[model samples]
Target: MEALKDYLPHSVEGKNILITGGTTGIGRATALLLARLGANVMITGLDEQHLKDALKDLYKEAKGEVYDVIADLSTEEGVNATFRTADSHFDKLDILINNAALPAGKVENGSYSEWQRVINTNLLAYTACTAQALERMKGDGHIVNIGSMSADVREETGSIYVATKSGIQGFSEALRKEVNKSGIKVTLIEPGAVDTDMQDQPTQEKKEKVENLEMLTADDIAISVLYCLSQPKRCDVVELKVRPHLQII
Candidate 1:
């Protein structure tokens, strides 16, 4: 049971994977995780320096093929160009991880600009990227959306981030029905507060404060991605939510 808990027939040794927002957080974590599993990983983000650093980290972890495409996922043109660049190299994408996301940054006193930026980057960008991705992927492809607890529970606030995240959940549900016959699976990964920059400065004390709990790590999320990809094509992994035990209501 232990060996088969995450044991599936599919392997990432030669699969072509495209991860958006691959510079930081879960996206970066997935890139390294997939690379280590022998997949040819391609990442996209706006930060050139960060991208370079992530590639280096990927090599250190996997020592294999890792490609980086520079593009802001916030705009239609950027999303389109990213797909074009990736398609030029790989004809089909076995896995597409829409992990690229931005935080809602202090919504209490935030203005409309902040809300719009969050919506554009986190919500619209994901839709645009997925559109271009579907055009290239044919059969048995996998799509994983890095969703949030805010989407399921009360929207975090400001209605900007919350609305966008809610869209991800809705899209995943609709996409599953639409693509069921197409052999493509759409899954939503809703995780609780991570010990990353997304939660602001998540220090050791803060991490320790939550006892009897399992704080979700980037690697943990990446492992979930790997697990889903490892499953047999006939099997489907739908919505999965990870919350630490100490996360009090």
Candidate 2:
């Protein structure tokens, strides 16, 4: 923790960062933290109100710049529009965090349309946003992809969600290898059962479901995001899997 606080802004201050699904939950938490730490943050979500709400507390704590883009992010146009919105606000970019995602669907008996919706939102849009962000990156940048434990575990309820997340892990790994020479780092941040909208907070019963460990707050995941970006330029924190201590994966 002292190292993190001391390393502080090796080059982070005034850096422009893009975060998808930043309206609420983990994305929002990460955005606020980066902003407080002196980075210029741009966030995207479908809800303008939620975006405002997310910024409410952050605005109070920080003095850095932050922008919000209202984008559906499930369609090609939405993805493009989000990039455009960020481009309009900032001239250069440094970080791209793919934090937005879609819900899971039952694959076996699910409708084809439902499957397409899930894949299109989770898989296709992530690709589109990454490509567009890369095009706008001024120099070497960071791409932090939020992946899932469900990708490796049994996502009995969310089969499609699991598939895309698994594919995301692969995509990030391949992209990291391809871009390593450029000094651009691509990392997959796989977290399990965070206390966010993507997963409900543990009920009294669910909390009891685990013995000693507590649930993961969005801030916990935010710290992980910071840790990745805080690494020295020559070293990359490629893949970080953060699960509650009691939940062994």
Off by over 4 Å in 2: 1-6, 9-11, 200-214
lDDT tens string, model 2, 1-249?
Answer: 346555655546788899999888889899888888888888888877897898787677655788888888878888888888888888877899998887776777678877887788788888888888788775689989999888789568877788899889889989988877876888899988777766654456444543456457788899999889888777789999998887777
Cα lDDT computed for each candidate against the true fold: 0.79, 0.82
Rate residue 119 of model 1 by lDDT. 79
> Residue 121 of model 1: what lDDT?
82
lDDT of 1: 0.79
* Residue 6 error, candidate 2, Å: 5.4
Candidate RMSDs in order:
2.6, 2.5
Among all windows of 10 consecutive residues in model 1, the one with the lowest summed lDDT is 1-10
Q: Worst 10-residue stretch by lDDT in candidate 2?
A: 205-214
**Model 1, TM vs. native:** 0.90
